[model samples]
Target: MATTLDISTTYYKSPLGLLRIGGTDTYISEISFIDHLEEGEYQANSLKGPVTPIVIQCIEQLIQYFQGQRRFFEFPVFQEGTEFQQRVWNELTAIPFGKTISYLDLSRRLGDTKAIRAAAAANGRNNIAIVVPCHRVIGSKRDLVGYAGGLWRKKWLLDHETKIQYGVQTLF
Candidate 1:
């Protein structure tokens, strides 16, 4: 028999707005903004399982991240995806917090220059978001595109990180 899992959901306010953090017993499963998922909708789906201590740690790390006090996150996350996606997310985390890389560059780094679209798709499906750092991936032409959190939020995040990297005041 397959192992059954129970998931937990919690809402927290962040600079991006209200966010719904979801987790299974051992790892964080999702982190979606309220505006994107709406309230009570995901709750109806019955999260895959209960929140574990590691999941709680991920939540706390996210809290620190949004406060601009954390430059990197170290937390366990469980994402469901194909091998390609897993590879893409893994490479995404390797990107430093305040830097940007192009999708074509990522595709090349993956040793397949033609896999840009696949790379973008993998980035779009990233469940762990900021922790995975998929936002660091941009268009080959240095344009921001295809963010699950919306382009505006992507720009905000990049700009914020850039400001933080330069030690400048981050203000819209």
Candidate 2:
């Protein structure tokens, strides 16, 4: 039998865009750039206050991220996917902030150099954005590519982290 969870959802207006955060009573299950999702998925969704504990934690970490104070996320991230995809997502967390890796490299890291397409597919399916760091996966030649959040936002995130990496401040 499968587990059934009553999901709580809320939205946060971030520097990049509006984000929808949702989870069950125990752990955060989804974080997306858009607030829109299938109606049926929202059936179990209980709208949460902006300051709910999990929502507050997510917003705080994201704020700290934009401010260059957070390099790693602390809140639990939950998602359901194939075993391969779960592995891919788990590896995404290992990518350090302020860094970029080629999708080929990510594929190789997953133990199959020929699985570049598969790796990219998994990256595309990732719903938890910043926390999962899917944007860190780039093209072979270091070109920014394949960000569901748009390449502009991807560039902004990479540039933002790079600024923090090089300690260039006075503007974010």
Candidate 3:
């Protein structure tokens, strides 16, 4: 018997936008802010089910993040990519809350300053949005750069986190 992979999906209505989360029960595979999920992911897989435990956990943590009650995510995220891309994602998690780092600096930390462009490319390919903290990355000049979810969303996330960390409230 050929067994199909067990994958599930759920929609999270976040302050930013509608998020489509897809993955297995044990780990989150892809989290996109857009309503549409790419092909061959949990959404397109043969076996579809209700939201898994990990997906529920991810949504809960995301709520906490937006509510300013959480700075780090603990859910297990399942992502398959090149080794360099994996390393880039791992480094993104280490970026402090409300803090931003440049792609050049990130590549430097990875021990290859010449790989800055490659690092940026990997950052753009990140599947897990807020959980992986890809929005925390910026241009070398401290300007906002590439973001799959859109530049406005990136700015909003930064502003939201910075405001909460600094203990300020705005009428947004």
Model 2 / residue 25 / CA error / Å: 2.6
Runs of candidate 3 exceeding 4 Å displacement: 1-4, 35-47, 168-172
- Give the runs in model 1 whose Cα sits over 4 Å from its true position: 1-5, 36-51, 169-172
Q: Could you give candidate 3's per-residue lDDT for residues 77-119 as a string of tens digits?
A: 8688899999999999899988889999899978999999999
- After the best TM-score superposition of candidate 1, give how far the Cα of residue 93 lies from its true spot, in angstroms: 0.4
**Leading candidate by TM-score:** 3
Tens digits of per-residue lDDT for model 2, 1-172: 1143366677767888878787665567778886466765444443553334766688789889988898888887788999999999998999987888899999999999999999999999998989999988999988888999888888888888888987654122
Clashing pairs in 1: 6-48, 6-49, 6-50, 7-48, 7-49, 7-50
- Order candidates by lDDT, high to low: 3, 2, 1
In model 1, the Cα lDDT at residue 58 comes to 75
TM-score of each: 0.85, 0.85, 0.87
What value of lDDT does candidate 3 attain over all alpha carbons?
0.84
Question: Which residue window of length 10 is worst by lDDT in model 1?
Answer: 1-10
Candidate 2 ranges beyond 4 A from true positions: 1-5, 35-52, 168-172
> Residue 72: error of model 2 in Å?
0.9
Model 1: residue 171 alpha-carbon error in angstroms:
12
